[model samples]
Target: MQRIDSVNVRPDVNGAGKPGFHDNADLSGQDATYLTPTWLNTVQEEICNLIEKNGYTLNVASRQQLYDIIATNDSVTALAEAMENRLVQLQAVLATKSALEQGISYVMSELGQHKTASNPHPQYLLASTFGVHIPMTAAIGRTEIKDENRVLGWNGQSSDWTANTGEITWGGSLSGSVEFTPYRAYGQFLLSGYISTATFFDVNVRVFNAEGIETSLIKVTEYGGSYASYGMNKVFEIPKGGKAVIEYRVDAGYSKRAQMTFSVYVDDRVKVFTPVGLTSVVDATDFTESTQNDVKSDYSSFPAFEWFYGDTNGQYFELSAISNMSDPVNKIPHYHRDKFTQLEKDLYIAVQAGKQTIESPSDYAVIDTQILRARTDAEGNVVVAVPLSMRSITTANNETLVYTFVYYLNEPDVTGALPVGLDGEHKIYVRL
Candidate 1:
């Protein structure tokens, strides 16, 4: 009538023949039931079916292969741990894929809008539009004196003088004097003269200033016996209200007579006006005239800005030297104010700022090409066709947004660990 515990049963014998079940009893025999063993086998089969349904091929029937895969763990623990590890890997892969998708979406949407979120500092755009100046071309006036004259100093006398309208003919025996029409204003004069026979003779031309002092002297000595013609050209600066007299003197030579003819030209053309904030002088006594009388000026002493002869219009002269002149002569205001529209100012500012933003040589090259493609007038003044803020929307906005995305994406996670595959050493497998 007492209940027997199953733990007290022996495996080898039947309960009716023995006080307890025999430990060596065969449960597979016809007299016994293998219910627990059957249930355990059924659970193992179910587990194998579940693994197969979940897209995994497991050789559960081959205990050796299963043991090889899960070498150091029990069968159930090994299988569960492997599945959990694989699931963790899958989650990491999915996270990375989602981040990429979101990043790409953000880039495409920002680019599609063709603009950024409202610029917090709209003043940068406004500053570009206000008070932009561009250079303009203005017609500069110029003049040259082509007037011709022939004046003889005297009819027959060498010392006494009278104006005669003929070439001055003098034997090497007699010297003569001739005068050019006095220049009314400060100007440059080009004098050209020729001597018929300069053989075995001493010929000299002296330029006397308004004060009757010899300012320039030119003398040519003849050494050959053959009669040859000599020509010379000289440039001289005549002061305002100044008169110049050229005295020709020649010693009597073997040649019977020598003919001399001279001509003068005055150039009053203004090549370029002195720029603003500078001083200039015309026919100043401070500089001397060298034989190389081309229209070159050295204004190193009176520096700020200077207009030399033959200067191009609208040329920018970099400041080099400072002026020490306590009182500069002929100082004049010469700079003209340049004006620009709002759009033009924006374009100019964009180009200027873009150039300054270049951080490398490659960037500089790209920016230079872009600037060249920008519109410009014949005078090299920038022209604006559209608002500069709208130009190169993709390049400009992408530069900013992509930079931010990459910077933040590269940052470490909350645990101070990099993404599973981005630790610089791990390999990642992406599904799509």
Candidate 2:
């Protein structure tokens, strides 16, 4: 008759039928915290078989072994070693211009920021702040489609130039807005004012992001570095693409006069290359698929995509700091006097935006590495067709699909005058 959900019940009768029995020992009976004592005692053999069938022996030794592994892996000493290695890498990268700086305020400023989802390094700025400007130049071309260059002057308060010592003290700060590319932001300062005997200048540079919500970075470098080492990459890398406002101040510095050549050049290390006809050939989903060979078809279709610096058919990847340029007698000379590094690496690809969808040629994508080689045309320019892909978030209205081709050279390091940092960074953006 009556069904009970739960009952405060217990068994009192022994197996011999008398109540309150078994006086010798109750150790022979099996018991479990989960199940009733009657059920456990009846199916003790089945319980052992179930654990054994799972191929794991459930015992105190097994639990102790698992505990030992977790303890060894999550040890404080192992975590400390990993942290120490990361600190060393950061220190090496910052050692260039941060030598005069003491506190790591620059590194700590990025503590609150979160990295990207898939590619933790950086991503391309889509529908960015640039007109229909072409990314390619005439013949030898490697220019960014979107770039910002602002020449800043030391407009802060400063003491009068000391005629006796020829050194003047500078104080206060001056700010300037610069347009940043996706991955790189460069700063070039003409420190001719800082050339004094036994005179050192501690300069603090603070960079803010486009939104100016938080501090992007702050680099403190003595104005005593060499001529070619004035770029912000020597201090730290700024991986933002938009309006970047930077404030420069002299914490402690002497100057002949406030140099007006403080400039920030926004040109990414990643290059944008628009293919000839991609949307007509490949689908947007097929662009990101692993089983595609756009590189092989690039020579006939994507002639604008160039990677290596070869002089086979009279075209070469040329980088010049101060080649074939007029002398700047009024400014201090370092790297490129024009503020921006001029690179001419490939032929110009005329921009052809579609009517239905927009094209973002500056968007960079990762290469599949299987199709990361250059195919030579019939006595034409060398075409390195790198089939690269990025995420395509479908929208309600129109969408822009940007395909990039990035190649990594498997060449060995050369110990010579030519500078080398080509660790799989031959990037090109092609419109699909």
Candidate 3:
């Protein structure tokens, strides 16, 4: 008796019944047990269960509906993710927009540029070659143009006043146009100049725009006859920017004329605030678990920080950073430093850093509604404080920590004389 392979050599029925009757009986049916037909059936059920667990129903009878919903929901989720990514970008744009609306500039520049980040105005310089230093005391009470007063004139187009007017013509100053630009909102200029009486005669100043329109006389008084050693100083404001002509008219006014000079100092409307470094340490794994309040112990222990202005533009949250890192101005924090105490330095550091963070939520944070009221202390300095709350974050090891933060009022960018219309009628004089 010999053993035969059951897979390829099946029992030969013909060999038993009839001699030499060979037949190749099919063995394909035996291979049918390799895998269960229902193996893939679980895949559909798994997909259906996934949808159902997510508050969706997958009815195989309505395959179209299931696919449609899956695609629709996928598209919606994709859109949501895209929107979240755009949130920060949109906030930056909105902040810039806010600054612009308040006549603020977002572009940074060097000092003395007289240009705001968002606004740049006309830049003026005096030609050094002109010998126009006037003696002191040439300007006195109620002085007008008279003989023997050496005038200091500017044509705006050139540094050579003598060449253009052929010896300082009274009305020969070349007129330049004054155009309105965005930086005009930051500040204005009114200038006045005259010859000193100590080494000179009399001096009077007048301003004219590019349109040949001369503004009203701003400095009409004379400084001569009494104060002979003091040079004249005048500060004024010009509302517009363009070619400005300063007329150096003079008066003999019972004094000798001296060499004259003029200069301008501008006050900018917007400024930059530098950021103090992060006082709190955030765990890389879970941001929500990172407590910020614990890092800053007190105002004295914390690094100084500053904030410029920002716009909301109907947003739920906004993030701002301090870019200026030099010469941080001392400011009264919304919360007093002597008030709180913690055993760990990290705890105080976290609190100070957290206080500066800005956020917008569906509802106001409990810490945002408080106000920073200021009162003059015995030292004549303003002290500000606000109401605040504490929050705790627990780690996986069951250790819990707390952070403190304060609520305060937000100041807008465009702030001025608070009563709105009170300063509207105020006027300052500009000479050139």
Top candidate (TM-score): 1
Please provide, for model 3 over 153-209, each residue's C-alpha lDDT reduced to its tens digit, 9 standing for 90 to 100: 221222111101112111111211122111212124323333433312333444434
lDDT of 1 by residue, 1-432 (tens): 222224444533435544333433444543323235545667676666455544356864665543444454565686899899989867765778786687678657644443464533232222222212111111112222233221112111111122211221211233455554231223455555556554333444455554444677655333334446676455555444343455553321221234444544433222222122211212212112222211111122222332111123534332211211222222111111112232211111111112112224323212211111121122323311112222233343322110000011122342322233211221111110
Model 2, 48-92: lDDT tens digits are 544544334667546453344335655556778989988997887
For model 2, the stretches where C-alpha displacement exceeds 4 angstroms are: 1-202, 205-211, 223-243, 250-260, 266-432
* TM-score for each model: 0.22, 0.18, 0.19
Per-model CA lDDT versus the true structure = 0.32, 0.28, 0.28
Off by over 4 Å in 1: 1-172, 181-183, 200-214, 218-225, 251-256, 268-432
Candidate 2 vs 3: which has more lDDT: 3
